[model samples]
Target: MKNNTYYRLTLLAVILSLSVTAATFGQGRQNRLTNSPREGYWVIESQPRQKSVALFYNDDNQLIYKEVLSKKRLNIKQAKTQESLKAVLEQALRQWAVSQKTGGNPIQNDQQWLAAELN
Candidate 1:
């Protein structure tokens, strides 16, 4: 019962957080990237003092990839712009490309994803 309650609360918190985030685009404070769309679909979740989490979802809404962007590379100031958002996504892929444990042909995966997104 206790575990179930905890799970419910956790789920509720996530739903609330997503709804609130979906409803707002306030700058420099949890800004959701806009004006840029791509294959599958990707979202940048940036928070102050927190390394932004990037989630890429397929057309069916299933998550495809998840990565954390570099703290030094996260440009919150320009994240709202289309070009900036693309750059941020590229940055995440570039970071992923170098990972040994990134699983499955990183270069091919990175190139394909980048081509799909940028082209």
Candidate 2:
């Protein structure tokens, strides 16, 4: 019973958070992204001193990929604009690519490494 209550509360928090986040963007045409219309529904959740989580869902509402952008993990700034958001996603993908090459060890959040990759 206690475990079930915990789960319910957690679920409620997520729903409420998502609702508030969605409301921030407004309705109808305002909700849609002009930069990447082909990508489908994308949800972004960001909070103070925590990792920014971006969830990309397909047209069928299936999650395609979820990226966690962390200052601690990648030293990246908060994604405030469309370009920055794309850069964060690209950084996450780049980390995945590097992991594939290096047998899955997590990469350090180094500015120098990121700068080299960008160049």
The digit string of per-residue lDDT tens for model 2 on 26-118 reads 764464544444434556677777766666454567554565666423323544445454554455555545775889765443233223333
User: Best candidate, lDDT-wise?
Assistant: 2
Q: Provide the overall lDDT of each model, using Cα atoms, as 2-decimal numbers.
A: 0.54, 0.56
Q: At residue 95, give the lDDT of candidate 2.
A: 57
Off by over 4 Å in 1: 1-38, 72-119
Instruction: Give the TM-score comparing model 1 with the true structure, all chains together.
Output: 0.33
lDDT of 1 by residue, 23-105 (tens): 67465343444434443456768777756665655456755556555452344455344464465455554544465366654
**TM-score per model over all chains:** 0.33, 0.35
Clashing pairs in model 1, backbone N/Cα/C closer than 3 A: none
